[model samples]
Target: MDEEKKGTVHYKGAEGGWGSVRGITETWMREVDRPGALRTLERQNKPGGFMCVSCAWTKPAHPHAFEFCENGAKATLWDLTSRRCTPQVLGRHRVSELKTWRDHDLEQLGRLTHPMRYDAATDSYVACSWQEAFEGIGRELRAIDPGSAVFYTSGRASLETAYLFQLFARLYGHNNLPDSSNMCHETTSVALKKLIGVPVGTSVLSDFHHCDAIFFFGQNTGTNSPRMLHPLKEAVERGVKIVTFNPIRERGLEVFRDPQSPAEMLHLKKPTLISHQYLQVRAGGDIAAITGLIKHILAAEEKLWAEEQRHVLDVDFLEQHTEGFEALKAHVAGVGWDAIEAESGLSRADLEAAAQVYVEAKNTIVMYGMGLTQQVHGFENLAMIVNLLLLKGNIGREGTGCSPVRGHSNVQGQRTVGISEKPELVPLDTLAELFGFDPPRDKGLNTVEACEKILSGEVKAFIGLGGNFVRAVPEREKMEAAWTRLRLTVQIATKLNRSHLINGQVAYLLPCLSRTEVDEQASGPQTVTMEDSLSCIHGSVAHNKPASEHLLSEPAIVAGIAKATLPPNPKVQWDEWVADYGRVRDLIEQTYPDEFAQFNERLFTPGGFYRGNAARDRVWKTESGKAEFTVPDHLSAAGFEDAPGRYRLMTLRSNDQFNTTIYGYSDRLRGIEGTRDVLLMHPDEIAAAGLKEGQVVGLKTDAGDGIHREVGGLTVTPFLLPRGCVASYYPEMNALVPLSHHDQESKTPAAKAVPVRIVT
Candidate 1:
């Protein structure tokens, strides 16, 4: 194919099959030889092998030999790459020059192979010993109040690593444990905690086998978690319906051809049907859509009872286990069909058809992603989903519950192991009693809160476990400008990223082992554990060689800091716990006895062990002591809906990208590639706005704060979409989203729905 044809080729094939094989082959050859790549792939998701460093999809009890997907292959092989960013490379480039590079190019510069410190005198980084780096970090942290320091972590780290990081922060002083979960699923955590008394999904991967239908909201199953396609295809073949509620028509949900299936692969058979119905919900319209579904079911239930003397609503289950039925019924009945149709951009008949599917299924699941969580009314949005499920009393059933499609692998695991801004979420009292020291009780900053503190001169130090924070958040212009105001910044990472270039007065880059690399410690080769989205914990041990000889395990890095920063407590042993990660798990067990009791032992089970949700038994820890229905006063916006020319912008990732890391320029499935500068809009809307296809336009966001927020030179493309809605790639378009544009309750950046206008 020609260069233009390569980027613009429309993928008419299914999600997997030949397309997936081509992708895997391309990435494997680019990163490593086929033999080496196969060697690594053979162990991925196995009983004691390394976990895929991609999405938080659960592992089946009897996993397929080829459990990894294209995304997984890219992530794993990227770590096993031969490229290395040695001291010589760092010495050759200036920070200013490196800051101007593309995100993909920056990470492609390869892995960091040494402990490096930023030298402001030369505007470059120089090699330093781990001891010098740790001591300098300790001295700087001690000079400032512990509360002034934000300890951030990415989801890539292990449970032991996150545990030590949190323990180190608490021993030093505060509970400012901000993580990737705060950016993506904080709405799920906070909302589910209030409604169901659990901050995680109650359904397991096995639930797909028994469920009659699955409802997906805002999450794309194909690109985000390709391995999840197996169960989805199986369910579809077994007569289960898949109903999708998303603003875009995702290729993965429509059709998938499993590459592992020899019959289909050899015969070149047709793709398996994935979604029975795909509804394009308008941006920020999840609440309206869900409300419509509930109303249709309620009306149907009344009709069934009044005419045929039959009942469909689970009145017995509701009366026995729930608390706020009358209020929910009255509030939903008060909502009009006209309002629902206008807000959701769907006709009443369409919604009624979708609702009838849910009403007929004996057991159903509601699976949602950031689409519902990253909005102004995200907290209220989640509760509404639970209300729909509760109308039929789906809770505590075999194949019925809520599922939050957590983006990063083990992001939820980090939160379960005490990485949170809220001090009360973790067992501080037990932590204190076990660790023999008084832990800090004050609430620390979350992602947005931490950024605000940094810009306001309150937070002066940042110690991130493993994320591209500054580049991944909103108000890119302001955050990048305010980044240098800090005194100290420490980032533990496997590769170079944009966040490292925006350095502090005293900055250090600590290189750590990736999940695919063996981590040798005092106790020899150690394995780390992670919790999947279904609350199951699995062990991961690396087989690939380290990217650099100088790299250290995350546990060792955390221990080094703990030893340098704190006066040794009588109960906590930093070195010993890290020497044997089993000690860390034991400590976890003692701290949270109910969920993690005998954690080490249970992790040895064939498919690992369940973290155990209280809601599985209909146990509600909410204030009312039962599952409660929440009714928001009104559907709200993030302060920009009333303004003219304000189009709802949903920022997303291309197929070849993850969070903020770009692997390639082309998103083959979308048919627009080779560059991340195109904006997609409806053809009618473009003509109505006096714009044409291929016109270079800019987007401007004015929150009325008088700050100039604009991104220029985006080539407009026509696509099938809801009116008044446009889509763009994330991190590239993150500049248009201001720091103030976030969910009101959870404070998650509403990247799914930023209000902006197209400019010439």
Candidate 2:
């Protein structure tokens, strides 16, 4: 069969105008039934309704009539689709055959409706009772040593579920609790805690109203979190200078028209310009760009000092509340401009211009995304950003701080509620006092470490709370083979994906209720809580009925498995906690009294409660008892001197997808339609590689670990990218990222910058 006609159209208008409305209409019509779709959307993001499962952007205090964005609508409709993956459907297909399907096609099969066990004889999944499934999982878990089991959590899990997940794992004598945060924001958390004594963004959502300038680095705000455009547009209208640094010229950052505003919808108003200045920094060059800006700021400060004028640097604040300023100053001063321009892909004049905006603004907010965190220098990149903010005393003020834009809905909440591999961070002693068991103290495996352990036959059993572990991790082929070597694997999820098809010696798939479904317990209908990117913990109550009668809440699934796996413990009332989720919240309060005080009562208030940070209150809890500036080693951008044909490839999400979930093939923002197998590159580089537009090509990495790392049949599409830099969609390009390629400190895969060679 001939391939679907691939077309690329350049979009000139603002984002979130008629295009967004049309997208919502088409998604509702195709994925969900008409009247039901409208009803589902009506209850979305309301006070007593389900939360959007797309991005973790904070909800507005006074929401508009329609509170969700286009991607939010897609997530809701995708979850509430009127389709089912029943046992009868599974009987028709074999596991081996289903494994050949694409990731989107597997999820398009529909929501899983029953518990299933792999039957190797027929190479198919057979329906099994919930009790039988739990018992079988418990048996395998008990058969292995406690240290040899890996328990992974997804960001989609609720606070209550994540708390129980950690408790069960620790009580069962294991700390190998790796979650999705290890792949995305682990560096942000680690760096912030060491610098300003907190692991969250310092600014709240309302801070946007008071900022003088907003610096966006490596974040595509329009595509990742479309709802954030509302505040950004308002900020632009107020004359707040928005400086953007991204490798690609994102359409959302250029201009936006709010679909919710009647004036914009009626064509009575023009589109709002978002960025005052857009700097295209090369991939993995964030450190160099930020360093150059700091150098410029320091030079300007010296000039002002020489003229006996007021300087931009907060001298009083730095002396009173910060340390190591002299060392940081000397380090930046020694760096030459030539190195900065070479590594950052920008001239000294551009850096000085951007620095001038920062020097003039009284209060500024610097927000960044995976572009800065998914690199070899990921942790150092975060430290440099903090260093810049501290230089001007921007943090802990009215409208200035550091913000790390998280992708998953509740990823931060998952980590806050004890989903971590480090025992020191999880408060084992406090948990032992509350639950009457000595929690393990040893450091456990992270995402990358878990893969290595599994592959080496060290970890025998794996249980995923709610993520596609095999597909989301690096080294896809090795990960698949490692799964087959495991003694048992269990997936607690809403939809059927590739992870379920790839089986171990004994694999089980347990269907769970989605966030949109009402989770009723013994007491009454329960409400789950999630923490947004701004550290706001809020309640989300589901109003819709369960999609399938067989579905169970994530908390209940954890409880059932824990009860069958461990011996009876009177101190830890697993049954009562599962019966009433309030009991679990009460336990969380007892464990983390400082952060989660009055967890049950406060979570019910309108708009929820803010988990206060010490750094926001101007209190420093670091080793120096004050904010500290640290100089980072300068690392050059990824390039191959040995192989001139090699290009730096960065994996990115299309506009239609969230993380590994592919909603559709069309990325309307980038003007690509009908397919995802395309490499975005510069025209000059395409020609240099002897490749033409629309020509089929292959990508091979230079890891040389005896693993064949290549992806074929990719069409080269010419676009404006930095020389020697290219872009491709993730999970598809995840094959090119080697397991050994990750940050040394955070262990996050450097998906944004991988050296590769293009082959015809």
Candidate 3:
């Protein structure tokens, strides 16, 4: 906590109005000149412009003139910042000295202008030629057993880059392709695939317009995906009911004022009220909350059955399109209202009210975010939501379906193009036939597994396409130590991050062009494609010049390393593929012909093309060939009943940040300012813990895994969080979350529901 900085201020208004304008303007001015900012802004998300490097929220069919959001503007300007990290900059600072700087400070050091290699003798990074850097990485990767090498990717990667990176990893004889999705939406993929036969949301952005009722569970759209507010605002104006479920009363879901609209921004129009009904569920209580709603609906349907009246459950859809309804109905009926009320932090009346809204709506959409997925029973939470939807036949119908609002621009695209650690999911036979090499069949390591492997010395080499893996993953100290154990670590990035600071015995930083920079190759300026949260594949072309002449496109960087590592195969032309990304798409189409047919042709279409979801078409691809209802044996709240003064802590992103990238010290929407070192708690809980507002405290996990896990110097603040539930900024509080504490089925870290004790 900086004494000179101002204390937190409670903002009393809606999000995304004048405040967003100010934020975007301030970020743009601080990073780039007016001309550069204007140039970037004009082309953002437009035809021949770059895709937003932030959330995966899909673009509208008809995008606005200013299509970007406040956070999007920050991301663009941050990438196109004039500040450069040249050789002189590296020469001025040692690795040890750089490690002392904060994460945001390190990022502000600006973009890496050239490739650099760690020199032990000099104790600093020395500028290296592209050829030498690639060959050195190639030699090191080849020296290790391919199975011992882990290739990781961030969601920021383009489809072409992801395809090439995965292809390179496979050709080298391994499938250890872990990605950021493993940490974020892997639970959604796993649960949705198991229940609905697809690993993505069934509904598109257009569904928001026609849906009679929208249920938002544990998502903060205002900060995470601000652009989503537009449709939400429209839905509100159209008199559609919007219901929200979360521990915190997020201002974004409550109300929003469109900054892009002149009447709202210039004339100071009234903010659009968002959620018609808001239910505050306890942390890790999403399963219980959803189950409670289902329980209420089931009870209502049973009453109607006893009376021989009209039923709420879509009996026709259930009989024709689904299975196991009786089992689900029985399970819900057995769960008492007392347990549901205690676990979900909602009364029977409240749950019944929500259930009534669901029953009355002709069509409904359930949208969720990381809040629902980053918990111990995350998979179960998703399953319950799907069960509710299935009861109403919400699958594959217009204005009705499940939507998981994803983070990152191309996370879905990366997974769609085969960036998976699971070898069984990869089209091994198709890949072998297309590339003329036998693909590895062994299941590889996911993010958590890769970290453990590195710690145990099972993995010797680590390559990251993008993302600050150190700060992004749990068990931060352990992960940093694991990196040092790696024989070689390689990062392909646009800017400096903490991951680069945490180095291996042999470390390399390969500078790559940002999404906003033109990726000119031997053929011509290449356009890369991205899949939004809704699975819409759209082309993104960069009109701006490269940030640095030395910087290479991610595809080119991957190609260079692949060429250096593998022997020439006449069947695969790495150089040609790098020169023209269309060739990469051709291969992807061939690999998943039915799904990606006409991939190149569709890239040119306005607003791009949809990769048809079978579930969306009511075409169930499950073993039974029908949508199956899953029944949870038990739903447990994540808190200690015996441990006194214990709080259920959830890690959240501030409005000033996106993922791990800290844009500023202020979270204006939450009224937090000047510091990220604070905990949000209910006033009653603060009194119960004998803590005063603004008092510094320490948080320690009760995991007691022999490893000491604690984060100190956190200021406590009273907010509207549920009792026994507390919130803190992520990455800062990531240390409190144990690596072993994860969702059982998906292996995704349970970052949202860590039980901890507060220390005065």
lDDT of 1: 0.86
Worst 10 residues of 3 by lDDT: 1-10
lDDT tens string, model 2, 583-640?
A: 8889888888888898988875555578888998889889999998988876453422
Better of 1 and 2 by lDDT: 2
Native-to-model Cα distance after best TM-score fit, residue 572 in candidate 2, in Å: 1.6
TM accuracy, model 3: 0.97
Model 2, which residues run further than 4 Å from truth?
1-9, 637-643, 704-706
C-alpha local distance difference test of each model: 0.86, 0.87, 0.86
Give the TM-score of each candidate.
0.97, 0.97, 0.97
After superposing candidate 3 on the true structure, give the runs of residues whose Cα lies further than 4 Å from its correct spot: 1-9, 305-308, 637-642
Each model's total of backbone clashes: 0, 0, 0
Cα error, candidate 3, residue 635 (Å): 1.7
Write the residue-wise lDDT of candidate 1 on 637-674 in tens digits.
Answer: 33356455778998988889888988888676667668
Worst 10-residue lDDT window for candidate 2 reads 1-10
RMSD of each: 2.6, 3.0, 2.8
